[model samples]
Target: MSPTLLVMLIMMAVPVAMVFVYSTLSNVVMERDPEFVGIENYLTLFGDEIFRKALGQTAIFTVTSVTLHLLIGLGFAMMLNSGLLPRLAAALFRVIYILPWVFTASIVVILWQLLLNPNGVINYLLEAASLIDSKVEWFSNPSLALGTVIFINVWAGYPFIMISLLAGLQGIPGDLYEAAEIDGAGWRARFFNITIPQLFPILLAVAMLDFIWNLQQFPIIWLATGGGPLNATETIATFTYNLAFSKHEFAMASASGVVLFVVSAIVALFYVRHQKARD
Candidate 1:
């Protein structure tokens, strides 16, 4: 316990404390005599147009990704758990659906890059089907880059929710459904009254956790578009990365990182509270 606690403090607490302290100072990591600017960094961040844009885009990305992940995951989970399909077919589909989750972000991004390229299979199919006359630059077009990245994120993320929800769905007693059927409840009614109620706790927990994960997603976006196409897909994670490494504004980046931390912390508090209530 002592060794584990020591490792935790060294690995997590020290870095967090350093970032928080750096967020309050100016010229950190770039200058020997950094000034203590207090909250000036945060003030400047909020006033900066790029930061504001990144903040808003981050919100949109996180919300859209989480919502789609939940919806798609729920749909797939229900299908897999419905027992309508044969066991072998269900197992095969489960493997296919969960395959995306097994790939690393780098691999996922590269795969999408190839598929979404101007002369790629996607555009070729669309062109062949007469869906479009010109090649679509999925990641290079400002209007579509954000949505494209969101789609990639959804593609990669839904499996987590699907697997978890499937487990939760299976744990539900068959007797509950039998009782609902005995009462002459239809599919919608049974799903709404029994399935939803039974799965609400798991849903809440996963949704909040997924929100946090997607809110800080960086690698896929960075690798796919580099938050490019005129900054259309710039998220807080990428913005902070650019600030720290690209621009060498360590203090400002630290402030941005702290902001992200605060937001995630708030969500985490809600998650903890919900778990307490559920328990």
Candidate 2:
């Protein structure tokens, strides 16, 4: 094989092969071996309340974070593209917005952890401003823990969406806006009728990608709250990690992973079909 072909086979083909082999082995090993129980691992996963809760939490986190990120990112992109700001000012804002995308997830998590500490700089500033009498336990409160993680995900992920939107915005022809203005269309009417229609494909693509990415986000939640405060923030990715590493249930972990993969694939397929129909 050619060198590039060899590399592709090694990098992509081998991992896919490994997954199939491992999944098949999981079934066979469980059945033939006395210690292994066939399909019991999979059954246990379905019957487990913790896993179900984790799935639900993951869904909520994915939907909320992706939706907010898309909305905020697109808004920022529109602001940047408005041409009201000076060239230098717009360039600076774009650079600042892009900073989060360049940083690694671990670094972002650590920085936010310190910022969120009870006695950290955030609380200190709030207290100095008399915002409250005491520091709030950002991660310790179950109600806030998952929401905080979702907020962090949005912060870290929005830059990519912003960049995508900016690209899409630039591609929109000035003639469309000019024609709308000639027709005496208001700004809101022009935006909704022209700009949004042109941007729909880009927005849909970004939303689908964000959904998949957020669904599998682990480091932010793991490092932030470790899915704590009574497992309120627990997600499928974190749950699978705990099952494999903490509980040492490799078979069950594989089963959970398969479930996640199937769900993600189904959602992706639906999104793709919808996008195709729209196109």
Candidate 3:
């Protein structure tokens, strides 16, 4: 425990401490020395409309993406375990499903950018099929940007949730399912009574984990949209990163980082408590 604690300190504590201190200073693009600014940085963030919008968009992205991930993951996991396909077929499909996850976020962004382009394969097919009369701007349209990014995220993310749920499904006691079968339980009954109940903990855990990961998602949106088309898909991560690297507002970026930390910490604590209760 002591060694593990030391590792955590090295990994999380030092950087977090640095950020906290940095957040207190007035560090801007042309400043030679950072001046202590107290709580002004945090206060400025709250009053900033762009920051507020980013928060709202972040909320929408995180909620929508995580919900889709869970639903799609559960569906795929059930299908994989249903024995509809032979073992070889199921195994092959499982590999196929996980292929998106094997690719890096940069790869995901570039491939999707091409697919979602106005004259790309998707729109080309749609137009040829007479689905739409015109090209649809995916990232360029403010109304569609966030949703487009969210869809891409879901496409790349569902495989992980599916794999996790599948692993959890394998741990359920077969005897319980057999007993349910003997009791004349239908598929629906067995799923609700046996499968869901046994899988609840894993589902809850993965939901929380997904929420946390989605909260910090940057590359998928950044590489693809860069929070573009009037900042429609702007998120906390992109906001903070742009401040630090592009705008060189170190203090404000650090302040945003601290806010993110607090929110994540609250969620993590809730998850830990929930896990303990389940245990």
Candidate 4:
């Protein structure tokens, strides 16, 4: 325990502390003797239009990704757990559905890029079916870039929720469902009264975790659009990267990172309190 604690302090705690200190300084990494500017960097960050836009887009991306992840995951979990499908079919579907989650972020982005290209299979099929009269630039079009990345994120993220909910569904007492049926409860009634209630705790926990994950999501969005097409998909993660690496504005970037940290910490605090209550 001592060794593990020391390692964690060195690896995680030290870096976080350094970043926080850097956030209050001016032109760190570039200056030999950076001056302490207190919250000046944060003030500048808040005033920057690009930072504000990235923050808003980050919220949208995180919320939309988590919501879609929950909905799609719940739908698939219910379907797989329903026992309506034959065993072989259910197994096959499980494999297919979980495939996206197994892929690395880079692979997922590359796969989507190919499929979403103007002349790719997706557009080709849409055109052939007359669903689209013209090729749509998914990543290049400002109007659609955010939604496109969100879609890709949802596709890649839903399986974890599905698997978690599926486990929770399986753990639910068969007798409770039987009792509900004996009470003349239809499928909808049983689902609403029994399934949903039973799954609520797991649902909440998974959603919170997914929210944190999506809030920090960088690789997928970076590889997909690099937060481009006129900042349509700009997020906190990308914004921080652009500030620190692209522009070499270390102080501002540290401040932006600290802001992200605060938001995540607040969410995690709620999660911790909820877990304690559950325990």
Candidate 5:
């Protein structure tokens, strides 16, 4: 093989080999050792209330964040493409929105921690404007913590969706809109009939990407709440981390990881089929 081919093979083969070896060893250890019982890790996962709750929380967070991100990002992209805004203004807005995606996850989470804190700048400003009576404990409130994290994730991640949708919007020929205008179709009708149908593939691709990313997100939740406020914000990723590192249950953690991978794969396959149909 050529050097480039050799490098690509090594890059792909190492992880695949490692996963296969690890899975085989894990099963063997579970079968032979009393410390690691056969399939007990999976049994624990299903029977454990905390794990089940964490899975539910993760699903909620992923769906809500992806939905909001797509809606807001596509909305902004449409506004930018509408020609109502000057070119310079639209470019500037796009640049500003893209900044969030460029920042490290740690930076975004830390910044949000400050912004969401009870006595932080956000509450201070709101108080000054008489928008609220007192500061709210955002991360400490179990009811609001997950939603707050989802909001932060959406805000920081929507730029990717925006850029994708904007590219799709630009590819759409302007004559379609002009023809629609001449035919007396309103903005909503034109958008629903022309823009959305044409952008379905891009939207599906972006949604799948966002769903996977949001589903596996760990650092943001860790930094903001550490899956705290009564484990209300625990995700599968964070749960796996705690199981492997804190609980010293590597087998169980691996099981959870496998489950996560399977779920994500299924979702991606569905999106692929849907995209194929659209094409």
Candidate 6:
């Protein structure tokens, strides 16, 4: 095997095995000795209200962010593919759209922090448009923080989806669309019938992968809100970090990590089966 593949395999496997072992015992980082306590961490996790909230938040975050990624990405891809602009212009927009994605996640979070401040340009634009009478607290308000994180995630992630769908769109034979037009089909009919059907397989694959990524998204949400304002924006990834490093609940953190691994594995298994059926 290639060195790169060997490295990747080791990287993926070792941490999971270590974390699973740590979950069944108390290993407070390097601060203390390891204690082998069976399933005590799981019991603590089950009774922890914060963990429950984080789990629910993760589900909401993953589903909403992934859905928006698909819809907005599809919209941009279709717009670019609509023949409304020249190839050069479309290509330029693609480059511009992916600019946010080119930066490290921490940098992207910091940039958005600047933009989403109460007195920031986003609120200024809103006020100029008379959309609101006052500044909106993007990260400080508990009610709005989770949705704000999801919105930022969508902004950072949609370009990848857009480019992927664009590739799939360009792969479609023009004759199929031309034939549909010749049969007197409206654009809506063509999109619903031809475009959707042809893209369904790719759509499922992208959706599954995107869901997995969003489920464990860490830096963006953490840097933006630090799972703050009463842990409103907390997801599993942030929850694990806060537990392991911040609070020094290493055993519980390892259990949370193990749970994430199991949940992700289950989702990936389903995705693999669905993809196989498509083939």
Best by lDDT: 1
RMSD of 3: 2.0
Residues 1-279 of candidate 6: C-alpha lDDT, one tens digit per residue: 699998998898998888898899876575567878999999999798988999999999999999999999999899888888998998898888777678888988888889988999999999999998999998999999999999989999988898889999988889999999999999999999999999988898899989888988999998999998898998889999998889888888999999998999988998999889987
Stretch of 10 with least lDDT, candidate 1: 223-232
lDDT of each: 0.96, 0.85, 0.92, 0.95, 0.85, 0.90
TM-score for model 6? 0.93
- Residue 201 in model 6: shift from native, Å? 0.9
Decoy 4 TM-score against native: 0.98
Model 4: residues >4 Å from true position, as ranges? none
Candidate 5 regions with alpha-carbon error over 4 angstroms: 1-36, 271-279
Candidate 4: what lDDT? 0.95
Deviation (Å) of 70 in candidate 6: 0.4
State the displacement of the C-alpha of residue 76, model 3, in Å, after optimal TM-score superposition.
0.7
Query: Scored by Cα lDDT, where does model 5 land?
Result: 0.85
Candidate 2: where are CA atoms >4 Å away?
1-38, 128-131, 270-279
Better candidate number, 5 or 6, judged by lDDT: 6
TM-scores of all predicted structures? 0.98, 0.88, 0.93, 0.98, 0.89, 0.93
Least accurate stretch of 10 residues (summed lDDT) in model 2?
21-30
After TM-score superposition, the amount by which residue 233's alpha carbon in candidate 4 deviates from its true location, in angstroms, is: 0.6
Off by over 4 Å in 6: 2-8, 28-33, 275-279
lDDT of 5 by residue, 1-279 (tens): 599998999897785455434433354333555342556667768899988999999999999999999999999899888888888999998898789999888999989888888989998998999998988888899998998988888888899999999999999999999999999999899989999998988998899989988888988888888898899999999988997788766667777777787788788898889878877
lDDT of 3 by residue, 1-279 (tens): 899999988898898998999898898445888888999999999898989999999999999999999999999888898867999999998998888898899999899989989999999999999998999998898999999999999999999899999999989988998999999999899999999999999999999989999999999999878987798999999999999999989999999999888888888998999899988
Instruction: Enumerate residue pairs that collide in model 2.
Output: none
The predicted structure with the larger lDDT, 2 or 4, is 4
